[model samples]
Target chain A: MTALPPKLQDYLDDFSFITTREERADFLIDIADSFQPVPARVASKPYDEAHRVIGCESEAFVWAVERADGRLDYYFDVLNPQGLSAMAMSAILDEACSGAPLEQVANISGDVVFAFFGRDISMGKGRGLTELINAVVYHARQRL
Target chain B: MSDIKSRGYANADKLVSTDWVAAHLNDTGVRIIESNEDPLLYPSGHLPGAVEVDWVKDLNDPLRRDYLDRAGFEALAGRIGISPETTVIFYGDKSNWWATYALWVFELFGHTNAKIMDGGRLKWAEEGRELTREKPDIGPTSYTAPERDDSQVRAFRDGVLAHIEAGGQLVDVRSPGEFSGETLHMPGYPQEGAVRGGHIPGASSVPWSRAANEDGTFKNAAELRAIYLDEIGLNPEEPTIAYCRIGERSSHTWFVLTNLLGFGDVRNYDGSWTEWGNSVGLPIEK
Candidate 1:
């Protein structure tokens, strides 16, 4: 298996040390607080349906912009104001995948959702978050 | 949405408006509880003085498929600082989907002094109501809960089978795709998909969200009646069973039928399609 991006691995390592649900929730909520939606310069309202993440109830959308160095910078927006999990997953992907090697970004497993959100998440929520990850990976794989 | 009383529900007291909740925010006799499918929702920001009762973590038994027992219920009630007389008002995301689920679980322990906040979290927030990140400092109470009773509002597999055999009313609160066997689960939600792709025999199709308006509040009595009775031909006097993929959605429908529509006898088959679709020799129809 391909190695996960170093920053993502660091996040997983940090999350691994957490033992309680409250701790995990606080950590993820902090990440969610940092989430920034795609700016008007990158994409505005009425985003193209093509970029929408399928299967995500959060109404999340993703975009990948090629940088001068050829690595991709990912931007995301979750339309649902209450979709904190989607926002958190989006923030994590934007941090971990942007400017990373395409191969490493493409190989980031959807299972990392469980690592961040924990297995106790409802089936509907788990599937939606995983689909968010899949959208990012799809963008990376498309450029490969 | 109109006023709760103006909505003309058979039992208007089962639902309280956002205004009612705002007025009762400091009511010592009422406990505001937030329940949601999204775990981060409660921690991020919730109604002031509202405590979170997680559907998965707080309500369900960790080691079993069932709900918490009497002892477990007591522990939870005590932790939430609620007595039998406390009026528990539940509200959350997805049109109070998880809220009703929690309320249903509370009913298992005979916590009947409960009501759903109409329109749930979205409505409250949209109306510019205050949401707080600060958790309340609750003074725990010693709650003496009755034994978990499955007979009143719950249905087992065999009982559902008997209901179908006896020509009882069954409401399948799943999407059209799931009802028609075109999809095993709601579009894009395959994690909870069952082995089979159809619904139980002799069930009427009514997606649970139909019971709610666009603002997350429930439809008025006339609108609900047009769908559940006029459209589906459900008799209010007959014993009825409602089910969905895992019973959460059906709990919403169960609430509508029992409290809003004044159905004489209604039960939620919590096992639902996950159990019926996978069980051996169970009859299913597209």
Candidate 2:
């Protein structure tokens, strides 16, 4: 469970139009109770500063979050696609962090979801893109 | 992007790039399905984790021909390891022509999640993406097909004849030579068919090649909208049927009109030229 800010919480309460509304309501109840921001570290310098990096546009950031049971999940977040800000990426993370029960809804492996999100960003379609963003926001508001 | 540019994507973005798919080569959840004709292409080399599905052998109803019946499709999906939950991405060479047809078949049975990889293997290999010879381990999964969406598919001969008689706009996406009965590509085809060895009455020739660039990626929204709206004068609201040789190329246009362009009532005449060109006693025009 993750604790969500009040503003996000209010947004979830008013969210509609997504199928399976009650699941979202249940998801909201769990996360609003308890959640925290996992610490993420971006490299001090861009790829040009890293002698070992060889790609054209390369940068790396890692996220470490402490679970309720004191377990830690560590992952490397790579920013490859241009115009996709770290803030937008974090917004997606915040949705997942807020207690979406992602495993229950689709069990999409985190890496697969991450890659899918990256591809979606590359395409620039607001159809499924915004829906996914709204899904996260809605989940965060209800659960975290 | 302007509305014209945005509108061009109607079928253009219905594809995923090989470079994009290659980046996720190791993803176990992303299953790739190849609906191709040649056995050499299927087993010899394909994108990593791709399962070959033959349209004639795996998809078509052997008893009925061309049309895929519910039972056959159900078994085919199971054989290809497609589940209701699977995000099935399909692709094939030649402008993703066959792949879009596969997408139509899947969507007709309610698998809207099925997306065609644009540019197909041609672009993928051109970009130096990875391909594999070893087949992935196959799994059996049950697929519950929803009722077929008849509104989006049609048989070639029947569709064209009906359109000619009914005055509906039949858009032929074949080459001008094929439409004029000058240079037929497919072997064992009769030469004395299709009204007068040409397109149906009231039909317009919009070659499938016009839909995409040489790289196989689609023309942007403005470009496609110009061709479909300004150039061809197709209204997005009206009923339109697209057809080409063997129903393959037409699926490309079908993908553009319905999926990318957001036209609701577009159907692909699957029997296409094979059925239309060989039919007895139809009006022919060069």
Candidate 3:
């Protein structure tokens, strides 16, 4: 397993509970465990240029970074997960790519993707944004 | 009691049974807000520990008519003992319409711990849960209200005009009858004779009744997914807007989409048709 990035390492340090990637995944799973979730399918792909990966299904947009260690850092859109206009999706892509070391995160097929995490009573839209940022920064931490 | 097999209620998670609520009626942190805004509906009776909040006056600010007021909402929340860290359980006798609206209002202002009691007061009373005639003593608490995001919500007039110009999805949560021009008595809206007495252009009608059962409680998760994903064809990743006559019914739909279905970008157009039909400059599409 590769080490985490400094920026993402700093974010994990700030959080009182979660630490490792498995812990983060477990946290999401626990939130999903609260509700009886419906069936959902997601489609994912890699953005080689931006040094990041992007995924989308009809329901959500999930973007991530592929590290040299083969770990996937995942970012997702919880607010508008299904389908977004070019303008709206463009803004989201820009926000996700900002300050990140990704070579590119673009909509190649004119389609956007969002990954449905799990049902969390406390996970608001803001948490969704936080999850995406955490995913990207953590994946970028391979060098550390 | 249609079938009463409990497809919606029995299968749902995040739902508090009337028995559960009745058991914990006196929990200190659990503040119940009475959502009966209708004057005729409110005066009759309410659940124990439930405080009244006017859907229009207390919850929303008519001056801007587009968003909720932070100070006004915080004051109301404080008066009801809803601090930022409080767990608010909302209920109402008049179905869950008002209760759901209150839930949406809390979410808009960044109060994430709010939940609507399933079946609301109707199921509680029906199941012999305690009902208090006299209002309870509510100690005021400090609730810091957050500013509502205007981009998340739009007034019906501007929303429709924007839709016509920009072409986003318009989701109308009114009954098929209302959408088809058969207007029942809609409060604070153009009822009798309007220029074009139908829904907005390209607006898909999904009756609010589809969301719940004959009882006031919402349907289960799988059922809701089918209704939104399969039946109504709502895509969670898409930018969608919900609206009703005054945004109450639509707020319920908004709750289902954002809270239950996990659709991130769902916004309720608070002005709804009341502001839309009443506005002269906006184009009317039957």
Candidate 4:
């Protein structure tokens, strides 16, 4: 099996130790606070529908720019200001998948959302965040 | 947009504005509660002295497909430091969808002193109000809650079937796609989808979000009347039932019809499409 993105695996490892919802929430909130949206150089308002993450209620958009070494740099924007979970997931994807091996990034499972956000997230939220992951993976698969 | 009272709601007192909440932040008789679809929202930042009540964890029964029981609710009430007489003001994300839902649950246990914060968290943030990450130090109150009385404000599957048989008014507060059977669930929510699509027969399609303005506040009474009473021709005197996937969105509509428009009787079918669409032998209309 192809190895997972090292940074992503580390995050999952860190989350695996989360024994309380409060701990998980605090960690995710911090991550969301660090989230930076896609720079204007990559995209802007009224983003192309092609980059929009399907099934995301957060109205998140994803862009995968190909680096010179054939790796990919992922950038994202979640339109809903209250969509902090989406923002955190986007930040994680940007940090973990960007410039990572295309094959590894493509192989990342959408279930990583459950790992990060936990099992208790509402069904709608879980699905939307999963779709955000799928959007990033779609770009990686397109490159491969 | 205007003062909540000036918006001409049938029950103007049911909703409080952000300014009211700010003024009442330190009022011992009132408790500010935030309930949201996103669990991260409350912990990140919230109204000062506000407590977070998660719909999934606080309001729901862990083992069953139902809400928390009387004992559970009492425990939650005590945990939140609210007495029967304490006025509860609920606010949250998703246009206060989950906030109204929490209020509905509290009502089931006879906590009638509940009100919603208009425009919810979005408006509060937009208005540049203070949001703090600090969790309030609340003293636990000994709350004695009555048994949950679902007959008044809640509808079961059998109750819904009989209601439809009796030609009771129903509102399908899902997206047009879901109401029309074009989609099994709201876009991006396939996991909550059912085996069958389409709304209950004789149900009017009014997406719950229509009740709200662009800023997430409820539309003035006249605009809301145009949609529910004028467009759909629903009589305010008639009994109504509103349902969406799992009944969270419908709670918003239930609040509108029951409180805003003064509909005499309205019940939210919390089982909703998840139960109806999946249940065997149930009739569905596209």
Best by lDDT: 4
User: Of the pair 1 and 4, which is ahead by lDDT?
Assistant: 4
Evaluate candidate 4 and give its CAPRI docking class based on DockQ. high
Write the residue-wise lDDT of candidate 2 on B1-286 in tens digits: 1222344465444556666577666666667887643223444468888887655556566676555767767888788787877777898755676687788878777777777776676667767777776778888778778666666565456665776788776788887877776755322223333433566667788898797877666667667778887888888887888987667679889888887777867888877766766678776666
Q: What class would a CAPRI assessor give candidate 1's docking?
A: high
The TM-score values for the models, in the order shown, are 0.98, 0.59, 0.58, 0.99
Q: What digit string (tens of lDDT, one per residue) describes model 1 on residues B12-96?
A: 9999999999999999999999999999999989999999999988998989998899999999999999999999999999999
> Which segments of candidate 3 are over 4 A away from where they belong?
A1-144, B1-14, B40-43, B62-68, B153-156, B164-166, B182-194, B280-284
Candidate achieving the largest DockQ: 4
lDDT of each: 0.94, 0.58, 0.57, 0.95
TM-score of 4: 0.99
lDDT of 4 by residue, A11-128 (tens): 9999999999999999999999999999999999989999998889999999988889999899999999999999999999999999999999999999999999999998889999
Q: Per-prediction fnat values?
A: 0.82, 0.00, 0.00, 0.93
Question: Predictions ranked by lDDT, top down?
Answer: 4, 1, 2, 3
Comparing 2 and 3 on TM-score, the stronger one: 2
Writing each residue's lDDT as its tens digit, candidate 1 over A1-144 gives 888899999999999999999899999999999999999999998999998998899999999999998789999999999999999999999999999999999998899999999999988888989999998899889989
Give the per-residue lDDT digits (tens) of candidate 2, residues A58-125. Answer: 13243434457533333333343211232233343455444334333232222322232222221112
Q: What is residue B234's positional error in candidate 3, in angstroms?
A: 1.9
In model 1 chain B, the worst 10-residue window by lDDT is B187-196
- What's model 4's lDDT at A141? 91
